[model samples]
Target: MGHDTVETPNLSFGRGATPDRSTPYARYVRLDELHSLQHPRSKEPAELSFIVTTQVMELLFDLLRHEWTIARQALREDDLPAALAALRRGTHAQDVLVDSWDLLATMTPQEFNSFRSLFGEASGFQSAAFLHLEFLLGNKNAALLAMYDGMPGTQAGLTEALRAPSLYDEALALLARRGLLPPQEASEQRYRPSEEVAAAWRRVYTEPESATLRPLGEALLDVAERVTRWRQRHLSAVKRTMGGKPGSGGSSGLTWLRKSAEQDVFPELWTIRDGL
Candidate 1:
């Protein structure tokens, strides 16, 4: 018996022409392409988990960048509510990112070692999306830009992010405009904690009832803490899987990750607590 092929009818909703089921959802989300992206080099079953988790983290990284950019723009427009909304959304996304470690945590050292060599020079250290996220969060390093020298698209995106005012930069500007921060030199240099910034945070905390920035400051603190937690968790994961050994991609591994984890995202936010 021969099976006959029949075209499926288009399922259209309200306005415009009807979109067929085969094309609508698949075309919009590109689920096929997305699912095809995970190409693990190792035959080890655990490598699938590793690759999928990493790709998920990369997607979440892009989401965080998008949310932060929205918050930054909202702050520039003096729309505190909108900015806070976006930051809150980011905190939710960060929560998922932190939880993602659970998947990789299940991988035993033997499981990871089975496929580690297959990664060659690939490392999370080279993730441009994560680097841009850090840049948007006010952690900028000119030397890091060199990592993408020949890759023009990534290099250009990084260049723009480096030059633009960071999320914290816009927050500081908002504080200054509201008579919270003292006038200081405005430079596009990387963010470094200062006594002046700490003092401004103290003011916000001392009189929370009257300060409109009180909630915003708290929201920013939440995000900073979550990001710090992610770094710490990453350090733990590396330590658990590979001790003090060098990373697969020329990275300093545990040592470098420890230093990064120890560095607070918004320094003044935490330092101000000591005075309070």
Candidate 2:
């Protein structure tokens, strides 16, 4: 009797194997390119986390801006369903943004100190997408526009955002169209919550079953709550990492964020809540 040695066939299931494009799972997410973007300036392992977290937050901010734009436009067209959908998606993205701070929150002051110098003169305060989001939410400040003057794309986009009606502004106009708010004002200035607008929101809250108004009011409230949570989380992250230290942008870190957080997204929404 002779013993025979058998060779096993090479199974093409490993990394070198060609991907089958026909399969649904075979489609590329371009994650190879996405994952390649995290180039931390320092050798510190914590620096990678810091950079990645900030980048992730920026991506979330972009998504939020996109959703809010749709929501604002929907409100302008008097399309409640479209506006509600956009608001709901923005709320979900806001949840992600709030949770992302947890990653940075875990960093001790010592860990942050390693890469803090690498971020010289750069801060979250200079986030253009964030500024645009603020503008879209009616927190417009002309001073912030100066930061983007060098970048034409960013400057142009932010300029347009500032000139356009804010989400709350569109909502208020919709209310006016429905006779819930007073007639639209003639001025095209930045939308400030008028006493009449606040009164209308109060009515919507008081009468919760008023067909279209109640849900719209609640949707706006949900967005406001999520936005507040994001701002608070951001302030807390800054405090946790840097304490009372000045921000990279030369402003007081936590102090500035706290003040910004205090400014409500939809002022009338919160103002009406107190009366309810």
Candidate 3:
């Protein structure tokens, strides 16, 4: 008797049936989920644009936080090359974030008024991610974390980030480790804008080939500049949109943002720029 023959269907495993390549014909990125997120409370066309722009900014904020974390870790390890790479990525991410404000800048007072009431008490002032980014950049304030008390997860995350060493702190510590800065214990009193640190950075800037340290100094300056640009753009957006109105979080809107923006990300970096 002849034995029966059987065959099983071939199934390609790993990365799914779709090949890991893209062309003009086919693309992947889960657009369905991304496009579905824009649910405007109002039927007005401008509402969709506003919602999308804010959502895009939130996404960019998340990216910036990721890059900042990487940069902070690299700085902690005294790995200038890795730190510079992460800082460059962060600067590019910030550029995208700054440009996002342009999208909302076009909203006139009339267009914003239509949906402004719909957003009652809901403003970027309550944005936990934004606050977390500030905390990571050494802009911590206990009051900012209070806004998240009702939300346990947000409060917890912000509190943890607040206690962690900021990006600038890591950079300063790196300087101290490399002997370019004064002793950490002595400098602990005023970690920011230290006269010693500023002088050290000035040396780095003036003497371009100071043992491969100039690149690290320049990279940090780039990060600081990008952060300042983001803050300025944010202030401009607030002024254009709400004028002098109180923020949804109960602060003086534009005025509060202006003060917040005035606080530098890397104080010594800018201080040294003037001397150089």
Candidate 4:
């Protein structure tokens, strides 16, 4: 019996075989729609980078929101490990969001001014994703919801988030279920720090082995710190590019950003650290 040698198939990607555009990667990612979103309103070459970078940040905001939602749901189900995993992922996404500022950090006032006027009344303040992210982080503000009044869908989405339990609320509820403290009241109103919540965080920090919430507390702090860092970088970027001028959306630009940066996400987490 004679044996014939068989040639193996050439599966070398991006070379021997033409790339399949119909693959799941292209379909799932929708690269065509994603790439098509960068529409610059100005002829300036830098405008393209600005538009793309802003779009990237918006996508990141949505990603972070999704992660927070997952974390909250996990907490609600008393799945501490899953909640921590989701929160850790969110922190990583936040770092990427912070670093994304580098893409626009070097823009001079003149460079931004070249196309700034073209976006009249359009500003980051009007970003629905960012607003939703803030709401999920427990920074609910009904006044901010007014900004989306004309857009029924976006406004309705924001209102829903506003009325839902925030990430911190879920964390507190989980801790309460574990007998760490009393259960937190789920409210759609703005978040106000409670002495009891602060004390619970202190207990978590002070007791390592006994406190089941220690790691969760740390994960929450990581998210809070990352958000603070992002706001700081955003403020710096805005200051460098626009100085103290009024924002495109009628905001007081640098002043508004500075004030917004002062807001501490998970305030109880930080206050607890000081006492620890």
C-alpha positional error of residue 51 in candidate 3 after TM-score superposition, expressed in Å:
0.8
Ordered by TM-score, highest first, the candidates read 1, 4, 2, 3
List the candidate 4 regions with Cα displacement exceeding 4 Å: 1-25
Runs of candidate 3 with Cα error greater than 4 angstroms are 1-28, 185-191, 207-211
- Candidate 4 contains a number of clashing pairs equal to 0
Tell me the whole-model lDDT of each prediction, alpha carbons only: 0.89, 0.82, 0.79, 0.87
Q: Considering every candidate listed, which one attains the maximal lDDT?
A: 1
The TM-score values for the models, in the order shown, are: 0.90, 0.86, 0.84, 0.88
For model 2, which pairs clash?
none
Q: Number of clashing residue pairs in every model?
A: 0, 0, 0, 0
- Candidate 2 C-alpha lDDT tens digits along 31-145: 6567889988888889988878888999999999899999988988888999999999989999998899888888888888888888789988898988888788777777778
Evaluated against the true structure, the overall lDDT of model 4 is 0.87
User: For candidate 3, lDDT tens digit of each residue in 1-276?
Assistant: 599878964555566566444443444566656778987887667888888888888888899899889989998887788889988988888888888888888888778888888978888878888888888877777767778778999899988888788887887787777777775532212235668878877776776556578777778778778888888998998788779888876889888879878877678777776656
Clashing pairs in 3: none
Candidate 4 is scored at a TM of: 0.88
lDDT of 1 by residue, 218-274 (tens): 999999999999999999999999889898778899999999999999889998887
* Error in Å for residue 267 of model 4: 1.1
